[model samples]
Target: MEALQAVLKSNFRSFDRVAVIGGLVRDFAREGRTGFRSDVDLVIHDSKEEVALLAEKLRATPNRFGGYGYKSGPWKIDFWALETTWAKKHVPMQTLEDVLLGTFFDWDAVAYDLWERKLICHDDYLERLRTKTLEINLRPNPSPMGNLVRAIRRLVLWQLVPGERLMCFINEYLDEEALRYMQKKEEELFSYCVSSRWKTVEEAKFYLFQERGSDDLQLDLFQIKHQR
Candidate 1:
């Protein structure tokens, strides 16, 4: 993972800030939140060419650590590239953000510590990015579990609706690995729900919650203004 991080830092020299968002970021950093399985989504604010150039540079690097590299999209408005296997698989959610989009639908409060994040570029840009970071926390509606349930319903609906578009959306945004795990968990939870395993929903809720502590960020310092 550090190798990928290194490539990103070296290639995108002008980025004001770079963050490993999506599942990889959450797994390595955020806890208590639900986990995901898929490619590492590195979200950075850079131009299309800058992002493409970074992907090109990284793709050139030999996979000493054994990982595939490729690119997708020149979506000018968003400016991101989806790196995945050169060929398609039965996999769902080809991009890193796909799995996260459903879960972390809320806006994120992206803070930058000059002393911490590997920020590049000029001081003025840094100040501007910092200001943007501090002003708002991106909140996505729907709980994490709610997002997962919604995704499953979509998958089921794809069968009933019988359309290529919904299939494509599922393929684009759902993580195959995570989806399988979720299916199994849902099965188990359903069995528990049917079996009257707990006295009430509230009683069962405690077991469903993930336990995590404050040191999860691995940041040098931070102040959580608010979190749901």
Candidate 2:
């Protein structure tokens, strides 16, 4: 966090709302770990121009995600703008909590407000993190396929067991249709799981079923469907 604070002090002090969000905060809260190989995601409630200006000030390279990336030692910092187009409305986020609420998983719904120099999170975020649980955000209606893939990857990467309630929710809410939807991204999802060190599709399936405990869930469900 010292490195982040230093970078903000030098380059982004003028911005009204700038905070470190997502994986970095989650890891920091859990293990006091920082500078993980994954990109450090930052959220700013400002115009595109302001985001660009800060990137320029920091000499950060722009990326296709409408964000800028900077290398601070081992950390790759990615800053994103908040007033993005959604449902034809330019919804601008006002606080760190608003940004946290928009994330996919409960553990990801945590942030360290640089401006206020404090941590903020959704209710139960810390507890869920402590328990190594994964949850889908229904309010934003995040892509079911993407969340499922991410949940699997996180379970492998974090060596986490699924929470009982989370498993119940998956069994009750995630149906065959949801599994079928993910088939379209099977290859992509497969690569993600393997890259996270699952080694084989069956290994990934084991962890997935560890929570689901459903005979209906099968490895073939994730296999890519070849066009006949």
Candidate 3:
């Protein structure tokens, strides 16, 4: 974090606004464990023209997801304009006081203003964190798979219980067909992010099939396929 702070202080001082948002801020504020492997999302409130120049200045690559990917030592940082974020483009989620378009989860909605040396988060963010629960602030997202996988990841990593909305999201999107993609992503994510295993399809089903609304949610989701 010291390296990140130093780099930001030196490189981004000229910018009108530069803040660190997403998982890094959320994790750091709670545990101060912004270690070498930490990834960051930077919110640069600026025009795309200047942001592109800034990306070049930092020797960062423009990612396909409309962000600049820059590696500062062991930390990988993604720089983005506030207006151009996927959350901002798809949803009108004004769930954060500091950030206009909030992220999918309330836990991820926190941002740390580097210049101001302050943390900005939603009113319920800290409370939710303290309780170790996950809540969805934005839905009908561009990437539903990403959202579902993250919920599962958080459930394992943080031992955080999925809130009603979050469970509904998981139950809605995760079907037998979608489970294959979920497993693929889980294997990749587990290898890259952490070590976890579902072992079998049935095992994963046991964990994720907690019906949030209707009792027939699982039955409605799965269908028997008789084959020769």
Candidate 4:
């Protein structure tokens, strides 16, 4: 964190507003215990062009995700343009509070203001993190599949169990439409994992079905057939 802080301070200190947001902030709040594989997400309350200029200044190459990223030692730093509308309404994201409000999950609605050197988070953000609870900050109204998958993944990774409300919401709220959306997402993710070599079928199945243990006769038969 010190090294990353130094890099950001040196490069973006002149900027008026800057904050480290997303999973990195969550990991930071966990006292460096939660392991994050992705690069750090930094939000600058400025135009995309301005962020592109900053990326140039920092010698970072353009990333495919409409951001700038560069690898420094073991850490990967990414800069993202701050936007107002993350889910539904298009609210201008001028303040840190706006960003927190736009977050998909309560636990993720935490940020460390680099300029102020302080943490800004939702009222329940810390509580949710502490309790390891997955609560929705913004309603997954249009599509709930992504959020559902994320919640389940976090539950597995964090070893935290969801409350009854969350379970009821998942089981009751999902209709045919939501189930179709989830199936599509699963197919797309599976294709990406295969094509990008991100995860083999076995690896994907292992993580997705980790709780099922290794005693599945179907999986055993499939492996035996493939080995022949």
Candidate 5:
């Protein structure tokens, strides 16, 4: 938090409405969580010129979604213009509230307002954190793998068991052909993150079923319980 605050003070004095959001915010608010190797995610309600200026200052290149990454010490900071966030751009979400609330995971559905020095949380976000539970707040996400990987991280590392909604989301995610094709270069579904957990899609299936204590879920190619 000190690091992030220092970053804003030095680099973004002129910018406004640049809030720190997602993993970092949740972890910081909860006083930290183990294995929390999350990159800093920020969204600014500023002009494209401001975003570009920040990119130039950070010597970073914006991705196709108009977000950029900057390496500061051991931390990699990812910055996106508020409108550039997936839910905002693709879902045509027109408000900051929409962007903030439209998240795949309950815990990451929060933002720390930099100027106002307050936290903006989505529904049941605080309660979920208190209970260490995993849930899907938004189902229309672009990356199903994003939700799954994060859920597994919580299950294995953070000890957060999935709720009914999250389990349903995971089940739906299982049917996504792209889940088997997990080689995409996306924000949450990094190659190392997935590869370190499971070498093959079948291995992932086995582990998930083993965790959830059920093999009723089926695939045309897999017997579900026999994936191992």
Candidate 6:
């Protein structure tokens, strides 16, 4: 970890709001699990080039992780030049406002904002991520028993949501502009499933069923569980 901080301080000109998030953050603080990787994340308030420069310097270092070609920066910058994407998904503003901001995550793997710490790098891009997230409609943390319920809701919404109707929505909705947000979320789903010891959603669904242990609930493709 010290090597990571040293590389960032040496390579990058300046940065802020550089706290880690995602599985790495959860692992260090909570007892959460994630797929094993030597890579250390530094979520900084900086540009892609800023991150890339750090990775280059780290590549020249002698550390074992570095020697073994372990990544020392954001995972995406290693790839070719591409257009960045962002999203304005509906998060419950009401819930986000109530969350105790500032580096908080739960055992359930839910993310909450750190509203107090603010910094700017790359023309305040991190600020934009934080502020824009405020507009996101956050939902409450789901209990162990809530998995099946939430899955059922998602399954139903897949049918009811407007964009779910067409593959053209893939091209239309997933325009170049939306790729960053889409890819970011897609990676998240991958990490969660891999780390949680669930091979598929069905396995998690069965676990949730055992938690609920209620005969009243019935599984069906079309049925919406506990309508919101």
Q: Name the candidate that leads on lDDT.
A: 3
Give the per-residue lDDT of model 3 (tens digit) for 20-98.
Answer: 8877777776787742246877878777778888889889998866889988887788887765767665665333344
Sorting all predicted structures by lDDT, with the top scorer first, yields 3, 5, 4, 2, 1, 6
State the lDDT at 52 in candidate 4.
80
- Which digits, one per residue and each the tens of the lDDT, describe model 2 over residues 33-94? 55343567888878888888878878989776567888877668888777641211322366
What is candidate 6's lDDT per residue for 109-167, written digit by digit as tens?
A: 22222233332122432343333111112232223123322333232332222112221
Q: Model 3: residues >4 Å from true position, as ranges?
A: 34-37, 90-100, 192-228
lDDT of each: 0.35, 0.62, 0.68, 0.64, 0.66, 0.31
Over 4 Å off, model 4: 32-38, 59-65, 84-92, 140-146, 163-228
Clashes of each: 7, 0, 0, 0, 0, 6
- What's the TM-score of each model vs. the native? 0.31, 0.65, 0.79, 0.64, 0.71, 0.31
Native-referenced Cα lDDT, model 4: 0.64
RMSD of each: 15.0, 7.7, 8.1, 7.9, 7.1, 14.2
Off-target runs (Cα >4 Å) in candidate 5 are 1-3, 33-38, 89-95, 175-228
| Candidate number achieving the greatest TM-score relative to the actual structure | 3
Better of 1 and 5 by lDDT: 5
In model 5, state the lDDT of residue 62. Answer: 73
What tens-digit string does per-residue lDDT give for candidate 1 at 1-228? 345445455554466644454334333323323533335444444444566666566553323211224442321111243232111122243433232322222212122222246422223533433321111121233234444444443223211121233233334444544455555665665432111323443432332222323353222123222210
* TM-score ranking of the models: 3, 5, 2, 4, 6, 1
